[model samples]
Target: MGVSGCGKSTVGEELAKQLGVPFAEGDKLHPASNVKKMAAGTPLNDDDRWPWLDLVGADLRKGYEADGIVISCSALKKIYRERLRESCGGPLAFVYLEGSVDLLTERMGARTGHFMPLSLLQNQLATMEVPTGEPGVVTVNIDASPEEIVANALKGLASL
Candidate 1:
């Protein structure tokens, strides 16, 4: 997972479809308060994210029991990822959608009807702990076409 506008939802959906697994939009699981905070242009603190991460993990666990699932989540920190892993209690793989700040900002600016404002992109990037060298994580560059990105992600995931 990566910052907003990194195309996590788009890639996750395509990846799940290709893998014949269920897909869950992690944003939908956010508590109203958290959504409200983001909608108001406020960056969330760790306290604001823990419970949400638990929900995402629970969804992952449920989906895992049913075969597999793909979810789009901004698991921005090592501790956050660890929490998700703990809560899921099963194997989990993250497809980190890495991209340049200009690309990310451009994409965010072009998007509409999303709760996350462009203003928060910087905050997310600053808060993000890139999943480099992390186990079970596949870092995919976001500078390519969606098809290419998903292809690379699938290849990386297969190697895992």
Candidate 2:
């Protein structure tokens, strides 16, 4: 969980593959209105996110019933993460993909077919809580290859 262009989906899919578990992209759970807002370059407020977070948490909880599941979610705020944790009945290990603003903007600028616009990067970064010292959070610097990032995430998750 990081900014919009923090490679959450790519890393999450790989992480799930490495762990032999199901993978869910949290963005797919967003309501159409929220998607439309972001697609129009509007930053979402708390009200716009709570319901989406609940759906993601529900997906995570359902997947967990069978096996470990990896989900890509930009749980930017502490309260958002708390909501997800509560929805799932407990905290889930979160792989916070860390990157520099420059790198993030670059990535966002290069991406296509995504609802989140590069213009909203600053707002996401601003809303982010960093998750430092937070339980079940594993921060992985994303200034490396996807393979390397996944490796780091796997190692970090194991230590948790």
Candidate 3:
């Protein structure tokens, strides 16, 4: 749970595979209007994110009986994470794929076929609250390979 280019989706998919759990891409749950706005290079506001966050949270909650599940979401604000927690009606383990603005911009620019633009990186970082002291949150620095990051996250989750 970091900015636009923080490798949330990539790491999430691998982590889910490692854990043998279902993986959900939170971006795909966004409303059409939100996608359109992002596709047009506009950063989304809180009003536009709450509904999408709720959907993602519900999806996460739906698999509570399973062994586990992994999902990629840019839960930028503390309130956003709280809202997700409320919707899930249970605990959640969040893995934050954090990186610097330069790295994020490079990653965003290298990627393609995505609605989130590099122009939105600064806005996302500005909105991010860093999740410090949040229960069940593991912050992983994005300075290594995806495999290494996933390994680190799995180890962190073990401690949680």
Best by TM-score: 1
Per-residue lDDT for 43 in model 1? 95
For 63-148, candidate 3 gives per-residue lDDT tens digits of 66565678899999999988888877677889988887888889999999998878888888888999979999999999899999
Model 2 C-alpha lDDT per residue in residues 1-160, reported as the tens digit of each score: 8889999999999999999999999999999999999999899999999889989989888877766788899999999998888777645898999999999999999999888989999999999999999899999999999999999999999999
For each candidate, the alpha-carbon lDDT, in order, equals 0.95, 0.91, 0.89
Model 1 has an lDDT value of 0.95
Segments of candidate 2 deviating more than 4 angstroms: none
RMSD of each: 0.6, 0.9, 0.9
Error of 3 at 130 (Å): 0.6
Which candidate comes out best when scored by lDDT? 1
Q: How far in Å is the alpha carbon of 60 misplaced in model 3?
A: 1.1
Error of 3 at 77 (Å): 0.4
* TM-score for each predicted model, relative to the true structure: 0.98, 0.97, 0.96
Off by over 4 Å in 3: none
Q: Positional deviation of 104 in candidate 2, in angstroms? A: 0.2
